[model samples]
Target: MTDQPPPQDQPPTPPVPPGNPQPQYGYPQAPPPPAPPQPGYGYPTAPQHPYAQQPGYGYPAQPVTVVAGSGGDTRRGENRTIALIILAAVVAIGLIIGSGVWYAGSSHGGGGTAGPGGGKNGTATVTGGKEKVPANPAADVLFKVPQPKTEDPSVPTAGSWLSGRVYAKSGIAEIIGYDPADGTKKWTLKFPGPVCAATERVTADGRTGIVYQPSMPTKTSRPGCTQVAAIDVRAGTELWSKSIGTGEFATQFRNVTVSGNTVAVGGSDGGAAWDIGTGKVLWQPKPGDGCSDAGYGGGPKLVAVRKCGTYGNRTLSIQNVDPTSGKVISEYKMGAGIEYAGIVSTDPLVVGADAGHSASGGSGVSDYFSIDNRTGRLLARIPVSGDAYEGECDTISQVEECKGVVAGDGKLYLATKERNEKKAHGSTNEVVAFDLATGKQTGQRAAAGDSFALFPLRMDGGNLIAYKKPPYDKGGQIVSVDGASFRSTTLMELPAAGADRDLQTDFQPGYSEYRYTQGKFFMAEPNVGKPIGSFDKDRNLFVAFGTRD
Candidate 1:
């Protein structure tokens, strides 16, 4: 495939702006030592011993004194009192040294507990030797890939998958698989055009779907996204490629996904399904009704978002359908005035929408509806204000593209907007959960300590995997919060200084792809384009960090 500029009629959407730089922290100056105990006439002459230095940073040498009394029984009481005072001083010095070590560890990338409060679950235990929490968690840069050069700044490059020991990343017009540990290129799958849409969900066997145009677009001619292909990421090869319709009436898919044995693609034109193994068309959108499938959410189950009615006045129906037959098993109709709805999950049947376009800050979500997929019953309508929570949904044709929110374990987890702390100079945030059945806050909050912001990545069994955007002078961290107790354990920490630290913090949440498996954390740009200026040659496409275990 060749690089192409977007058509004149369809302008490219600008990417999200980079995040503000965080303030760096420096070690505090040590305070002066306490004045030596004042001597009095009643007090015995100050006894002095050799001074011994503390074992940590910023601590002054401590003096150990021995009190000797030549006076007889009358001085016994005074001797006893002096001994007690000396003992107290020794204990205090030990505590100060211990505290110093802890502070130093936390400032660096040492393993430290994080959250709003402690939990009853205690420390998490490693299961199957995967995702083990390190005692002093720290990660080293595994590799980085520079952004591919492109004249057009709007070329889509949004796809990545980790299969077996290989990491496959979408480039300008190709998918390349690289060694997960090193930066060696394993294989490449070339496409005829840039990838327009890609699904994050991969089949159990490492197969995924993507939509692209058949040829490159030029100044005068631009092609529609009519090609759909299934790739076996594990094998680093394309399984099959196909398209539908012809000429101007051809269906241009906006998104693609895989569910069971079916590869589904949808758009404003309509929806269609095909067999994954054979690439044979299974079903197409039926006519007679004004409704059309806007998009689909695929994983475990396939749910379609069907839009009907005339423009400016539309209704949406959420359908749980059989993947192979395209049969609607259950349906829930959304209220009018909701022009678009994004699916947060297919199994739990959670939908997010901006009702009446009331959402602010362009989050594209004003509320969430939790439905029972089996019976098509609305369990609860949870109101989420854009001003308080940080969740995003694409207002375009991508229905399953949402960020900053994760739904699992019968709960919807959302990250709160970052805010300045009342007692500190840096900012902080928290991840709060809402009960899907009741549509109420669970009162459980996992905090991202001062100077850090937390965003939910995905769920691991019952736990929630979260990414902690680090403050300046520190490295980003991956944490796992216990589902039952809300306790967080650090799984991996990135570099704290040098070029690695700069690269690690460059990929901000909500704007980049973050994947953590085993003990490795991968961050890649979802879309890459030409830099705005001539001096922006240092742009990167992908960076990986892994624990030193």
Candidate 2:
């Protein structure tokens, strides 16, 4: 019973079509901006990065690699990236403290050697969390490039860089020296054009941060041509720029992130990196590839979800890309019932939601896994509980009524889906929370019509954020739960502002159930939900909507 709601007169996909109208999501639709279709619950290759991964889990032993080059995901949700050897990984050190295990070497082992500009010595820290960033992380070396010279200080103005926020209280968006605390503007700086996506990266300096902005493709005739701009948090100006794949024919940018002085990106052809300051091309493969995955962010190391040619009747390829040189270091293929779910967290590692084919090859298997970027390892994995589908009476068709799993912090929390079972049995459905850290059952809750599986809210400061769907009579308040203690609290109704509303409106209501962090919390509204995934701690939890000049 996939949580997909049946549209008006839309033929229900396979198995057993639910009896009546779309059950759970009781929502009205309005003409909004046309939304990209829910990313086929996948990217063509593997998973894209925002340097975020699913949390509450362990790492995987296997790496997901396809031949390479990923594209497609109208349903591409708000996935972001981490960048610079001025790396986010070092900032992510705060994350390892909670894993309950500290070792002499990272699962990926002595991180990959730094590429050009990765530091005169080569190599710096970057971040990726969505995939199983295990032992062999793609080289947390977000920067092999050297740092740039300081720019002449100037008055704050539009285009200057701000810390994390996009605009100044003065209503001006800076390219550098913009402060998040106030609307202070810095120098006049325009980031690279047609910014496709952007995010905040923690730098070596307390006041310094990195932002990666990808521009729209131009009408050129190159194969790989794109620009990645690195801005100074204190000054809001361009530190450097690198031309990625040709921008003309291939305009789609898979992911852009900064790890220290390095800026990595997965493009329509392959993954590439540049020294944040020197603007040196780090690495490039002979044929080159777009990236293995499409939803995660790109940095020193990039995990791609690719479709290696049809072999053995399976098509998915998962591999790690060296963003700097564009060389693929690790690769593996995904087959048999595995489908890209969504990102769990952004820093420390990458996370994913994957479904396996059932015994009948129809009923899907729901499990979650965490990846260590360096090793391409699976840190943790948790399968859904049997009772997860036990509620519905009568043989509920696997199709038309199956609910899957969502990952965050090593825990694969799945909402219960039993066809008319709750109503038939006069019982409420429940949500089964599985602990992937130890493959143990933590708890469960009674629910009704568990439709679109709600994902984890987010985890920070050892606290996990999530939403309590209404089927169980729970308020849609943003709930906070202690990671170790499993304590829960209702934060707020969260602001539904920004483009998220537009995206949400595209689907039936009963399907969405995510609780995460992106700062921007208010005492009166301490829970302003961001549109994208925010897993790393350095990422300031702030609020933002489309901006106006």
Instruction: Give per-residue CA lDDT, model 2, range 1-549, as digits (tens).
Output: 012121112112234221111111112322322222212111111112121111111112223332222321211112223111100010000010001111111111111122222221112221221111112211110111111111211111111122344332111122333333342444456543323323333344312222222432234521222455565554445566555335343333434555555555543233445566676666422132222233233322344444321211223334455444434454334433232332333233333323332111122233434454445455555443222332111011101111243335555455443333332322333334555555444543323222212324334444444443332222223334434444333333322445333222322222221212332221111011222323411221122221111
lDDT of each: 0.66, 0.31
* Model 1: per-residue Cα lDDT over 27-145, one tens digit each: 12223223233211111111111111111001111222222222110101111111111120110111100000001113323223543233211245633224556555678999999
TM-score, candidate number 1: 0.77
Clashes of each: 1, 168
Q: Which run of 10 residues does model 2 get worst, by summed lDDT?
A: 85-94
- Which residue pairs in candidate 1 collide? 1-192
Q: TM-score of model 2 relative to the true fold? A: 0.45
Q: What is the lDDT of residue 255 in candidate 1?
A: 79
RMSD of candidate 2 to the truth, in angstroms, is 18.4
354 Cα displacement, candidate 1 (Å):
1.1
